[model samples]
Target: MKAKYLVLSFFFFTAGTLFSQNKSVPKSIIKQNASILKFYDKKELQSMQKGQLLVLYVERTKTLIKTLPYIALASKPGVTMVDLGIPFTSENISLLDTQHDATDKFLDITTEFQKGMLPYSDKESLIKAILFYESVLKQMHELNEQE
Candidate 1:
């Protein structure tokens, strides 16, 4: 009986340890995160005019707004937006409409994102969409300072 109890305890402990291990983040997500960091450099964004950034932001946000629901539905649960190496948050998303005429569209994207939408089919596309959003926000801030 003592030997049987020891075996059972060992089995349970080993099983729990195996099951509780943290799953590794996918290589694609890591690569996408790196790409986003490189693409949205602060100096580069500061140099771009607000109009250019606005146009890019509006177009990419529109695409994300349209496709994010599908991506969210198809993706596994617990998948999240790749880290963009910036302070992207719900508040930042809400502020997207403050500088643009497409307020409704921006609001739509923010709502979808808040609802856990993943924004694109692949990591690369998602990275581009987020980078554009970040760049536009930076440019908008610069423009506001100038005004």
Candidate 2:
């Protein structure tokens, strides 16, 4: 019985660690992916280079708004560790659930963007669909700033 209890506890700990990492991660991850943004595009990303400029040239006095609030609104279960300084962990949902089957289209878009391939040939449509993801990420950034 003692040996069995030890084995079960070990499995639980390992599972918990995996779950935590999947949910939260850390800030360096965002900066790292942001650097790879150029590679995420399949066609000429030159158009988005201009969008990058929108981020750079935008005025500072515009007042930083809460992006995480919108994100938390979407997630429904609400955020975890608003004090953790990393937003995406508890604030995002698993796409695997039935009630959230709505996330499939979004997930498919991300898979295509990251791999730089269209599962189908409709590259433009995939790119357009990817825009919805940006808003979620932007909200995560807002949470980061809030922290």
Candidate 3:
């Protein structure tokens, strides 16, 4: 009878502790989302020249790569790309260094995002492409700043 009471008491204590813990999403995340939506509009992306878009993409990618380690450390445990609304998997994180190296090599030769080397012709597709990197960078910065 005493063991049964103890078990119930422990369970309630754990439940109360978990419930009382702060699990609210940070304010920075809300602000970041707003910033991304405002800045990465599809219409704006559509208006940009391919070369301009490419330069921005490459720059943002490089920034993201540099910021990623701090992001990883500062982020809460079990925070997945899905949690952040980033449409990437853990596997993609492993590939960023390789991608960064290639982009760095390309940038070394020329500062232009060449016309013939366009990643996407469709305006919507281009927005999506740029949106992902920009979103990650913005969100990570917000998260890091909060900590």
lDDT of 1 by residue, 70-147 (tens): 232221122233343433455544343233336445666675663454432344444455586666434433442462
Compared with the true structure, model 1 gives a TM-score of: 0.26
Worst 10 residues of 2 by lDDT: 57-66
| Model 2, span 14-108: residue lDDT tens | 99987775434222211111211222333443355544423321111011111222344322223333433444443343421332343335444
TM-scores of all candidate predictions against the true structure: 0.26, 0.26, 0.41
- Expressed as tens digits, the lDDT of each residue in 1-147 for candidate 3 is 999999999999999988894533222212121122234666788888877777666565545444454354433234444456654544554454355456458645553543445555665656687888777756765775673
Q: Which runs of model 2 end up more than 4 angstroms from their true locations? A: 1-117
Question: Model 2 compared with the native: what TM-score?
Answer: 0.26
> Where's the lowest-lDDT run of ten residues in candidate 3?
27-36
| Count of backbone collisions within predicted model 3 | 0
Off by over 4 Å in 3: 1-39, 73-122, 145-147
Q: What is the lDDT of candidate 2?
A: 0.37
RMSD of 2: 11.6
lDDT sort, best first: 3, 1, 2
**Best-matching candidate per lDDT:** 3
lDDT of residue 91 for candidate 2 = 37
**C-alpha lDDT score of every prediction, in listed order:** 0.44, 0.37, 0.55
